[model samples]
Target: MHNLTSDLALALEVADAADAVSLAGFNARSFTVERKADKSEVTEIDRATETA
Candidate 1:
């Protein structure tokens, strides 16, 4: 039970970090863009969000 609690806390921390990265990118006006293999739009924000 203690281990599960610790793991959940860690996951929440990671989520918060990711949210920060995503929000910053969302607010930024400029970022790179490219097409993925599936022909979908991709951008620098996308990469940063994934990394986070």
Candidate 2:
């Protein structure tokens, strides 16, 4: 069974992964934005971070 400490660790790990993807994209500043079917903006970094 999972406890609070393990759950928190997993959450932090996921957050770190997401941050790394986002920071890399922000630093590179080369990603293109596209409009989704709903007319919302999204980029490859967004998808990558979500996957992370």
Candidate 3:
């Protein structure tokens, strides 16, 4: 019983939540960046966004 409209709305809500956490970190300049073993750079905001 999947509904297209509702699914899209849910997706948008998730995006908004992630954005909020991301922007908060950016605005406060409190995020940390780390290099993974793969040599890719990621930030605390990145991890928090995924957790959101």
Candidate 4:
């Protein structure tokens, strides 16, 4: 049970970090889009969010 609490807390912290990255990049003036290897459109924001 103690470990569960710690795990949940860690997950929440990670989510917060990811959100910060996404929001920071959300309105980037020079943001661009490109096709991924699978032919899907992706943006700098998406990569930043994932990298967070």
Clashing pairs in 4: none
TM-score of each: 0.71, 0.90, 0.87, 0.77
Comparing 1 and 3 on TM-score, the stronger one: 3
Candidate 1, after superposition: displacement of residue 29 in Å?
Answer: 2.3
TM-score for predicted model 1 compared with the true structure? 0.71
Tens-place lDDT digits, model 2, residues 1-52: 6599989999999999999999999899899999999999999999999999
Across residues 1-52, which tens digit of lDDT does each residue of candidate 3 receive?
A: 7799999999999999999999999999977789989999999899999999
Candidate 4 lDDT tens digits, 11-47:
9998999999887777555788999999999998888
Give candidate 4 misplaced runs (Cα > 4 Å): none
Give Cα distance to truth, residue 9, candidate 4, Å. 0.8
State which candidate has the highest lDDT.
2
Alpha carbon lDDT of each predicted model: 0.85, 0.96, 0.94, 0.86
RMSD of each: 2.0, 1.3, 1.4, 1.9
Which TM-score value belongs to model 2? Answer: 0.90
